[model samples]
Target chain A: GIQVEQSPPDLILQEGANSTLRCNFSDSVNNLQWFHQNPWGQLINLFYIPSGTKQNGRLSATTVATERYSLLYISSSQTTDSGVYFCAVGEGNSGGSNYKLTFGKGTLLTVNP
Target chain B: DTAVSQTPKYLVTQMGNDKSIKCEQNLGHDTMYWYKQDSKKFLKIMFSYNNKELIINETVPNRFSPKSPDKAHLNLHINSLELGDSAVYFCASSRLRGEAFFGQGTRLTVV
Candidate 1:
């Protein structure tokens, strides 16, 4: 089993602000993803960065696999972005029986208008 | 159209009741998964099916079973549900990729 830890378990930000969330894993990962769980309970895939950086709209993600850490950044945040953000890491072994992903506890983000 | 969709947006039942949640995907994916988000908002993998075959079975309780009648569908059945079974259930689909498309969750409440 792999251990994933997210920082700043709870975050509060004013609308239009920018923020960065970090996820650190205990081991190397073959897959890394950032997800946003909206108020309606839909898990929206934010990024699929096992390594390198990716950007989409107001968000971006960077995964430094060699350092066992990843980051998600939200710019020009909106109130609708308030919810739980999750970072998950799949066990590095793609050929093993444990291809399951281990998720971090999540960072609860609150956007204030 | 939803890439991944689930039926019964909300479920409420008695402690001893039995229920099921249905999921479907149109992304032509070969793998599907069921995940449970407990009260603490912790998402854990319950079961996974690949091409209608059981591929990953976590340490889920025996009362929970997953059935995949075809590549596009995977349903979860719970028997004699307990109060602790109350949570949000999410359905996700993916192939040999890192990202997964998730359906709107089904909130289950046991009284």
Candidate 2:
């Protein structure tokens, strides 16, 4: 099983601030995704970058598969962005179970207005 | 329309009771999964079904059973629920190797 670790277990910032959250895995992965668990407990897909970089509105993510690391960046954060950010990954060598995603503990972000 | 939806957004039951959570995906994905989020907010995979076939079953307890009637639906049943069973359960769907979409989550409280 692959292990995923998220950095800075907790983060707090004022609105309009920018922050970078990191995720490091112990093995190669074929699937990598970033998700935001809003205050209401809705898991919103942020990015599905197995490799390369992708940006969605004020959120962006980059995954370096070879290095087994990924970074999620939030620009000009708003109060609505406050919640838990999770990084989940699926091992490339899981055979028929490659679709199984192992999640990290997550980074708790709080953006104060 | 919701890509993935689950019934009973919240559930509360006494110990020794049996309850089931239903999940359906309109995205037509082949892979569906059940994940549990504990009180501390740690998320872990419990079971996964691909194309209506069970593929991944983590070290979950026997009390937790997951059934997939088709590629678009997966349901979870818990027998004799205990205090430890109280947590948020999430249903998700995705392509064989694509990004996953999660439901709003069912928060279960076992009294």
Candidate 3:
């Protein structure tokens, strides 16, 4: 089994603040994804960065597969961004039955207007 | 249109009862998954099906059963529900080696 840990379990920011969320895995994985679980419990995909960096709107993510870690960046945060962000990864070399992504506890972010 | 959808946005039932949740995907994806979110918001994979074939089944209990009719629908049925079964369940779908899209989630309350 792979161990996934997320840093800064909680965060608070202003409307124009910037923050970075991190996820570290105990094993190597080829499938890594970032999702934002909105207040309504809607888990929306933010990135699929198994490696490298990607940006969408004010959000961006970077994953270093070899280092077994990934980062999610939120720039100019907004009130709507107040929720929990989750990082999930699937171990690539764990033999069979390792196709599912193991999720971290998550990072709760609160943005005030 | 929604990529993934689940039925019974909320479920409240007594212990020892049985319930079923329905899921469907309209993204033309071949793989679908079921994830359980506990009270503390920890997400864990329950079951996964690819192209109508069962694939990933975590260490979940046997009381939970997943049924996939073709490639577009995957349903979850729980027998003799217990208090530990109370959680928010999410249905997701994706293509092989692609990003997954999750549904709105079904909140189950086993009283």
In Å, residue A99's CA in model 1 sits off its true spot by: 1.9
Better of 1 and 2 by TM-score: 2
lDDT per residue (tens digit) for residues A1-113 in model 2: 78899998999999999999999999988889999999999999999999999999999999999999999999999999999999999764446564688999999999999
List all candidate RMSDs to the true structure.
1.3, 1.1, 1.6
lDDT, residue B45, model 1: 92
Between 2 and 3, whose TM-score is larger?
Answer: 2
In candidate 1 chain B, what residue range of length 10 has the lowest lDDT sum?
B93-102
Q: Indicate the worst ten consecutive residues by lDDT in candidate 3 chain A.
A: A90-99
Per-residue lDDT over B53-102 for candidate 3, one digit per residue giving the tens place of the 0 to 100 score: 89888878999999998899999999999999999999998886568889
TM-score of 1: 0.96
Q: Please tell me how candidate 2 rates in CAPRI terms.
A: medium
Q: Could you give the candidate ranking by lDDT, starting with the highest?
A: 2, 3, 1
Write one digit per residue (lDDT tens) for candidate 3, span A1-113.
Answer: 89999999999999999999999999877689999999999998889888999999999999999998999999999999999999998653434334677899999999999
Clashes of 3: 0
True contacts kept of each: 0.61, 0.79, 0.74
TM-score of chain A of each: 0.96, 0.95, 0.93
Pairs that collide in candidate 3 are none
Residue-pair clashes, model 1:
0
User: Chain B TM per candidate, please?
Assistant: 0.97, 0.98, 0.98
Write model 2 residue lDDT over B1-111, tens digit each, in one string.
Answer: 999999999999999999999999999899999999999999999988988888888889999999998899999999999999999999999887678899999999999
